[model samples]
Target: MLSFVNTTYLGFENIARKSVYTSLSKDLALKADEQNLTTLAKNAKFSKDEESSFKNTIHFTDFVSNTKISLKISDENLSNLKAKFAGNISLQEDGSYILKKEAESIASGWFADIAYKRGYLKADANNDGKLSDEERKNIYSYYGNGGFYSTSGGNVATVMATEAYSYLRAEEDFRDFTSKSLEEEFNKTLEKDSDFNGEILYGEMMSKGQMIAQAQSYIQNEGYTPPTFLEDMMDQFDQLNKKMLKDLKKLLEEKRLEQEALEKAKKELEKTAEIDIKHSNDQSLDKNLEKIENLKSQNPESQSFKQSLNLKEFSQAYMQSFKVDLKKELILETLKKQNDINYPLDMSKTKIDLKI
Candidate 1:
């Protein structure tokens, strides 16, 4: 999620702009050479391939009046740097300098440092030294930052952490509410032995009308209502049972056809993907065969292509494995090997003797 922290600062003297870019470029180079950001050996190899590929590409200038600046790093160091920041690293189209220090300050450990600290702590409520959701929200609201930290001073550190934490806490609250609601709904539907047995069973086994008739019969026989306890229990049971059945059925049948359609779509997607994969493999094989044929046609015997093309170095590589004049091959091999190694002394340095 970390991107380059790019910021533009306007109005730098031309000399100042050049000096700033030169300093940044030197720092980047030192990091590349000594630190080596790539973790894998294969990554270094990939870097080399990209390095060569860029060299083969042609770049056109947008303006005719623009002058080109040429810079060179050894081929061995080529992979360590690829285009990177050539010449001026900071200048905008309008000729402005970027403030590197401020950019670094904004970008350095922006979220990571705060996230680690926010893990265990909660919002302290009542000054009791313990944290809960309510206390955390209260503290944040009081501080105007909506987090555990105070941001009234307008300091960058407090503002950034408090703001980020406030948003995260709100998200946590929403998720917790959704989960608790689901749990409550599940619990509401749960049946227990106490809900069905003994005194309740006698009432639950009878219909509401039957219970009413029993109560009336008892009332008529005893010349009184007989408290009507069973009647009341039966009525309540009937209402609860009806509600439960309706909810259970609704949950079961909800979106049944939509679920089926989604399953059918998933199967069709898998089938189409299988066909696409087969077609892709077929095309790839054809391309590979074409590349093989082209390579074969460019063999050492292809005199016509050789006369028109300057492919001497490439031809040498192709013929390197074959038995050829040992001396000639060694010389060619040494020259080619030079492209991949660092020589200790500068080849261009000349020793001079002066009479004083």
Candidate 2:
């Protein structure tokens, strides 16, 4: 009975070992597959075809790998792995990849590399694998300006592709068969023009018009017809000039109306001041006349009393005239006080209250 028990225990031990080995082998295979997928994703290039497919498949693969690893790994170990790879990639409930800083940086760099390669190929005018100064300038003008790409679109790849396409199209449109020769001639003509002093004191539209006219005149004097493309450019300049003139006229009209309003306000203020001065003078004159009447009643027959009354009246009038002159300064002070209170005194709206 003891021999039979030992044999049964050995058989059970063998079965347990087989099961453990099977589980270990499966885990190893999953780990290998995860590594392979990650390698494929990191090395994939940005291509016109299968781009979206590669991105989706790789991101999904990464998601699956992380999910499986998270089941067995400690949280600390997983965090260390994420930090090491600079990948804080997360999966949304909708199965979309939420790529944070590192992933975005990688994708942007890739897109920029592709765009530069494509743009350089088109912009090399002599096909010598080197860009001329003019070609470089044109490329910068179209792409270096921030407006070439729309940031409102969330897809960085699509925005970069559009920018590349536009740069190539602009190159084709602006390129002449004579290459940079015509552009050089245009610059030389502008430099020779006495009116164009290599600086634009006026607005941009006016400067552009001057440049276009100068180019046209130079072409005509040399007895050569201007290119159709150049004439189209000139027409665009003309349209811009008309729009600028309209804007300038509207601005000038607004300024003129403002000036007229200010002048009318000044005249009204002067009229109010005159009325205030006249009213003050009449009050002073009445007070002086009353004083003279009182003196006449007090000294009825002094012989020199009339002379005294006349002299007093003349003195009061002279003093009142001096006070009126000082009242101009007082009015200015009152205006300043009103301004401080942001209360404009509109005499037309309310009667003036003279407190002389």
Candidate 3:
């Protein structure tokens, strides 16, 4: 019986046992079966219990590392994290350690404790209003001072209020700085086809052609040119008319000179021709009279001689008179044609004398 009991003890020890007390003790891990102790023992050889324990260990390390809980953070690392949240460092209420301001506020933490007790910091023995130092340290570790202590001679609320005001002022100044730029205003103005304030500049009010026509009409209607004193009033329109008038005057003056040259040439030609014709006629009359005198000497009582002299002499005189009239008519006709051809522009304004 003793040998059999020993072998049974060895077999039972090789298998695992299940217990209700062990199942109740563990809430997270899978427990041994309450109804089937033999099945539990048989499955123990192929169970994941040891592998699960290792997996849990790794999970715990990963969670702690990721959360920075139980793991001490360097100040530089903490500052980098704080910067990501635009956070600042501050002391905790208990003065035990620093806290991140992004985490808590005055409405929470010791204030809650103080208010619950009676709004007095002296009621707490541990200084942080919490019952224990570790709790106070944990609260401080999480909620930092944020410079909000009364005993330290600084008011956290006032500091916070002032910082807020400062931030607002900085924001206002920054906006003003950006809005005061003239470049944007200039670009906007350049983009518009017209002027701002809905007012048109002198140039914008009228077109170039319209303005010129207006000035010309005004000058013509008023029968007046711009005075030197008021020449500054010359705009785009006035300038165009001024140039046109100046050119027209120059051309008219040139034409007048040409007309005078033509007149002089015609007069000279007529005068020379008249002189030649008169000289030729006078010589012919003199030669015919001499011939008549010789004929009279040859026949004193010849009726034919007397009649020829009277008729020939009278015809010569009449021909000379006719030639003089024709020459005068030709000169007059030439002058009339030149005057008609070289008429000045705007004749009503100024007369250009073409007569030489």
Query: What lDDT would each prediction earn against the true structure?
Result: 0.29, 0.37, 0.31
* Model 2 global lDDT (CA atoms, 0 to 1): 0.37
The candidate with the higher lDDT, 2 or 3, is 2
* Candidate 1: segments with Cα more than 4 A from true spot: 1-229, 298-356
Which of 1 and 3 is the better model by TM-score? 3
For model 1, how does the per-residue alpha-carbon lDDT over 1-356 read when each residue is reduced to its tens digit? 11112212111121121110001121122233232221211121111323322232111110111212111223322222223323323444543223233222211111111111121112322323233455333221110111111112222111111121122333333322111111121111111112211111222233434433333343334422222443465579999999999998888787787788866875565455445544544454455445445655778457654552347744443333232344434444454465453323231242322111
Compute the lDDT of residue 248 as modeled in candidate 1.
Answer: 89
Clashes of each: 1, 0, 3
Q: Once superposed on the true structure, which residue ranges of model 3 sit more than 4 Å away at CA?
A: 1-235, 306-356
Q: Provide the lDDT at 188 for model 1.
A: 17
With a 3 Å backbone cut-off (N, CA, C), the pairs that clash in candidate 3 are 91-145, 92-145, 212-237
> Model 2, 241: alpha-carbon shift in Å?
0.4
Candidate rank order under lDDT:
2, 3, 1
Report lDDT (Cα) of residue 331, candidate 1: 42
The deviation in Å at residue 283 for candidate 3 is 2.4
Best by TM-score: 2
